[model samples]
Target: MRSHEHAAIGALCGALAVTLLARGRSFLEKLALWTYGLLLSVFIDLDHFVIARAKTGSWSYLTRAVRHPVWAFTEQESVFPDVEMKLDRLASHVLIGGGLVLALRPLSRLLAVFSAVVVYAHVLADLLREIEVA
Candidate 1:
C-alpha cells in the first residue's frame, strides 16, 4: 500500500478509537488523539531508510530522500522505485511501539492504553497492507 493509503487507514482507525474510547472527552481531546494515531501510523515508515541501508549496505535511498524531501515526504512509494519495499521492518516497529506504551505507562495509564490502541490500529493497517502486497 501507499503512504496515502496508510494515512487513510490510520485516520479511520484513529477516529473510530476516539469515538469509542473517548466518548466523554472534549472535541479537542478526541482530535488530539486522532492526530497522534495518524502521525504514529504514517511516520512509522520513516525507519525504512535504516532498514534499506542495513540490507543494501548503501546510502543511496537515504540520499535520494534527503535530496527530494518533498517527494519523499509526499510520494514515498513512488520516490524509491528502485529500492525494495521494507515491509519486513514491522517487527521492529511493533517492538518500538510496545516500548513506547511501557514507557508511557508510568506517566499515565490512560495515555499508555490509548497509545497501545493506536499502535495496534497502525499494526492492523500494516498487516492488511502486507497481506495485500503478498
Candidate 2:
C-alpha cells in the first residue's frame, strides 16, 4: 500500500476510536478496543510473512500494551531470531512507556494518550514500509 493509503487507514481507525470514546464508554473500554484492534492487526500481519510487516505489527502491539496499565506487567517473548532482534530494539518503547505512565493522572488517561501515540506510530511505520517496498 502507498503511504497515503496507509495514512488514510490510520485516520479511519482514529475516527472509529474517537467514535467509541464518544459513545459514553469508559476509558478502560476504549483502551480495550484499541488493544484488541492492535492485536488483530498483528494477526493480519502474521499472514503476510514479511519481516517489516511483522516489526510494524509488533511495535503496534507493544505500544497498545504500554498504554494499558494492566498490560504493563505482561512479558512478550519471541522464539524467531528476527523477531527477537526487533524485541531488543525497544529502548524507546521502554522510555515512552515509563514517561506515559508517570505523566498521566490516571491509568485511563495514560491509555487515552497512548492510543493517539500508537495511531501516529502506525502511520509512520506504514510510511516507512511504503518507502522500502517501493
Question: Cα RMSDs of all predictions?
Answer: 2.3, 14.6
Candidate 1 to truth, TM = 0.81
Q: How does model 1 fare in lDDT?
A: 0.78
The prediction achieving the highest TM-score against the true structure is 1
Task: Compose the digit string of candidate 1's lDDT tens values, residues 9-117.
Answer: 7888788877878878899988888898888778877777777877789889889888988888778667557666445667768887899999999997766877788
lDDT of 2 by residue, 16-121 (tens): 7656554677777666666544543233223222443356565544444447635432332222324433333233334443564465536666355545555445
Clashes of 2: 0
Q: What does the lDDT come to for candidate 2?
A: 0.46
Spell out the clash pairs found in candidate 2. Answer: none
Clashes of each: 0, 0
